[model samples]
Target: MPRLEPGQPAPAWNLPTADGGRLSLSDLAGRKVVVYVYPAAMTPGCTTQACDFRDNEAVFAQHGYAVVGVSPDPVEKLATFVEKESLTFPLVSDEGKEMLTAYGAYGEKQNYGRTVVGVIRSTFVLDEEGKVEVAKYNVRAKGHVASLAKQLGISL
Candidate 1:
């Protein structure tokens, strides 16, 4: 996977959302987008990360950002997760991993003392023009959204 840096144009993609909606990169063209890529759905770490975003959703909207979470889970699973977590944002299904690859979110990593290839937790903040303003990869699940909020200067 190629490492995307800040100021790079975010790659275009079309993926299925948990609500049975299809989301294309062009759909977010004129809006600020926060694309969060995670390994799977329903896991503890992923759940914590997603819940943080869920909790801070309004703050993100107030800051003119649209939040989208991407994972390799199927839409049905994603839907269940969203419903369970009461997540209001879009949860994209990257079952084919194309979106994850394009965003450099899928790759090899160490898991439980074993080296394996998998989706790396990452976040991309894109401007209204689709240029990446912030790229955070290999992030810890705890307090990450709050950290991102701080980085964006969003109070609460």
Candidate 2:
């Protein structure tokens, strides 16, 4: 799959959420959406990234953006991660990697100095029309939210 680029229509995906509900990208149409794809849940870097988004959730909402975190984890694991971090955003369970592949978020990753197949830490900021406003791939799991906020001129 080709890497997603800005101005391209974001690949529509559906995944089971932590609350046993299905979350589809199309359902979020007419609203700006932040799709942060992480490698896994409960990892330190992932945790920090998720917490940052949670902390600045209000700022995102004030800008008419809905945030969703996606990972190749089961619903139960996502629930535990959410409860542990007190995250208020939707945690989409992409256990099958269908959404990940569609969005080009799953691929080779350097882990512990070894190249391995894994989910690439990435974020896609979609506009109200479902067009990709920003497609930031290969992002570091830490301090990414701050960078995104700064890029968007969000005061938070």
**Candidate 1 residue lDDT tens string, 84-152:** 999989998888898888888888877889988999899999999999999999999998998998999
Runs of candidate 2 with Cα error greater than 4 angstroms are: none
- For candidate 1, the per-residue lDDT at 11 reads 90
Candidate 2 has which clashing residue pairs, if any? none
* Candidate 2 lDDT, 1-156, residue by residue in tens: 478888999988888998889999889999999999998899999999999999999999998999999999999999999999999999999888988988889988788999989899999999998999999889997789989989887888
What overall lDDT, based on C-alpha atoms, would model 2 receive against the true structure? Answer: 0.92
The 10 consecutive residues of candidate 2 with the worst lDDT sum are: 1-10
